[model samples]
Target: MPSPSGENPWSIPENDRLSERDFGRIAELIGEHAGIKLPPTKRLMVEGRLRKRVRGLGHQSLADYCRFLFDGHGLTSELVHVIDAVTTNKTDFFREPTHFVALEEKIVPALLERHASPEPRIKLWSAACSNGAEVYTIAMVMAEIAARHRHLRFSVLGTDISTEMLEYAAQAIYPVAMVEPVPTALRNRYLMQGRAPSRRSEVRIVPELRNTACFARLNLMDTRYTIDRDVDVIFLRNVLIYFEKATQEAVVSRLVGHLRPGGFLILGHSESMIGSNLNLRQVAPAVFQKS
Candidate 1:
């Protein structure tokens, strides 16, 4: 059959093509376990992404991979890789520039004033932090704020379902092109150029900024998050668009419980509509504050 992309699955060698039945099973498992809705349109994409996994696992075909996963007890060990393969990690430093502007100009100052401690420690979370860009971005903003306000301290927690991404994020290295979105001044302040010739095309977040950031693997589909509940700002951006509406609301509601009173929740620009009923007030474009 011709897939949605107008490619005939049968045109590929039989061992490489994914059958309809196997695609359906894979879609069901991904939706059930990850809350990501993989409709028919995504079949070709999924099949393409999993081909490397099939070869890596020494499977002869997509069918054999499915059988190994479903019938041959490979799922328990392979599910994480499956999820990693499918979950899209589209992120860049300062991807949405205005969000950081608001964080630095408005949000952080407001939170600092409201905090009662002698030396306030602001807690920021990048809920679906992909490769640590968002977390490090937040750290850069917080570092600037802390410099001006001598009594302030901050920590950033970056969590993602992809252990693969979390590991990459922990390393804090990126192609020089990826850091281009960061402002020149902040880039100079927070990023260190690689000293070795082979690594010259890469930059690493400075040890000082890296020390303020931490990464962890967290499944948002899980009912409870094991991190701090007094988060001053939660950046749950972009990833929500991939979920069903009901799942979107459920995830946002749970995250809302983690925010301190007057703390902020920032969603992707497209996600503004989902959390209207959850004790939040729209404070900016896709930015919400807990009452």
Candidate 2:
């Protein structure tokens, strides 16, 4: 059959062959290192992404890349690139504005009522924070709210597996086109226009807002990352769809483990705990509370 592009699907050579044992090895390697599962289907997907890497690196086959990964060359770096390629990071300023509104109206107030004391602290994690927009948006909201409530403090921790994305996040800069949907008042308050070192002058989030958040390179698959301070809310949004059933369960368990008792866990609107079987109770629309 011809593909939608009108090219014969079979005309292309079978670029990669993923054996059952190789699939198991891929799953074990990814799971042990990054808590990601490479099911047979996803293993094929990985093969497709790495097929070009094989050509680029002058390797004979996908098996060669696997061997390179095991020969102490530490393909974790390359694996991270593969993840960056496969993971979709489509987000914008206040993409789901209602959740921020709810946080401002209901959640933040409730958290303050309980924890508003000397050095009162609130910790939030953007588990799959991509390119920093969501993290910065959360920071802007918290900073605005905290300014009004002197008795409370808040900090945001944005973590992602892609070092390339983190570099953009750390720079705290975005192009003008990316800021179109941002409201003017908020844009002026939170973002400033200036020349980057190379990309010329561009719009950037104000240092005051940027200062309130921190970005880290983290792989969500790591099971032992226990953030010492209990988190009040976690924005593990829009990133779980790529995982398989068992992998999704393991990731949720690790996520809930980091969540403080009674803390809220939010996922992408399309994602749900219906089949996830995680230990969380539905509190609001698309929102789950740790038991």
Candidate 3:
């Protein structure tokens, strides 16, 4: 049978073909476990990603690999690898800078007006902080705020579903080009370049920002989050595009539960909360405030 789009379904290399049934099952498991919705459209992408895992694990066929994930007995370690492969982790420093601009221009000033106190603490959560860019971006902005308002304290809690990504975040080491988008002054202030020969082409987050930040593994499918109860901002950008509407609502609800009453919730530019039925009021492009 021709593919739904009137092209070859088996266009993927015959050596690493992912059958329709296996793709469906994998999609279902990923959706159920990680709240990531995978449809037939993602078959090629999924196949390309999981193919590496299949080869690395020495599974001769895609069927054997799927079986290892679904039916194989008592191999929890393989499941983590499969889930890690299926999830997307595309992000970089100062991504969606307008949001950070908004934080400085509108959100933070309003927060200061309402929540200022002795030894003030501003807690923010980078909900889908892929790698470490978004968390450190928040840290950089907060670092600026802290310098100006010496009384204010800033703490960022970065969370993700994939342990591998969280591990990368914990180290806070990234390529040289990754920090290139950061302006010169901020880059010098917040990033440390590796020395020649051994550690070339790399930069790590400065120790002070690293000390102010922390990371945790969190699957948005869960009902309760493992972060602090109250937070002033949540940067859940770009990741929700992978989830279906119902999944988005469920995840947003859980995130909303952790946000302070008047705190800000920022979604990706493409994602939306219209008719999401959550108790949030839109304040900017993809930005919302909990009422």
Model 3 scores worst on lDDT over the 10 consecutive residues at: 1-10
**Against the unseen true structure, what C-alpha lDDT does each candidate score?**
0.90, 0.74, 0.83
Instruction: Put down candidate 3 lDDT per residue, 127-191, tens digits, no spaces.
Output: 98879889999999989988998799989999888888999999999989888879899998998
The list of candidate 1 runs beyond 4 A from truth reads 1-11
Q: Find the candidate with the highest TM-score and give its number.
A: 1
- The true-versus-predicted C-alpha distance at residue 284 of model 2, in Å, is 2.1
| Per-residue lDDT over 1-291 for candidate 2, one digit per residue giving the tens place of the 0 to 100 score | 644334454654553455576667767766665655565656545666556666787877767666776665746567776566445567787877777887788777777767747667889999888899989888888888888878677889989887878888988889888877677878889988776576554788888888888988888777667564388988877677767667677777777788777787888776776324676887666678776
Clashing pairs for predicted structure model 2, backbone only: 194-201, 195-201
Instruction: Name the top lDDT candidate.
Output: 1
Q: Select the stronger candidate by TM-score from 1 and 3.
A: 1
Task: TM-score each candidate.
Answer: 0.95, 0.77, 0.90
Error of 3 at 288 (Å): 1.6
After best superposition, candidate 1 residue 111: deviation in angstroms? 0.7
TM-score, cand. 3: 0.90
Candidate 1 lDDT, tens digit per residue, 61-117? 888899998899999999999999888889989988899999988898789789989
What value does the lDDT take at residue 75 in candidate 3?
A: 42
Q: What is the lDDT of residue 196 in candidate 3?
A: 78
Q: List ranges where model 2 is wrong by over 4 Å.
A: 1-67, 70-78, 116-119, 195-201, 274-276
Error of 3 at 229 (Å): 2.1
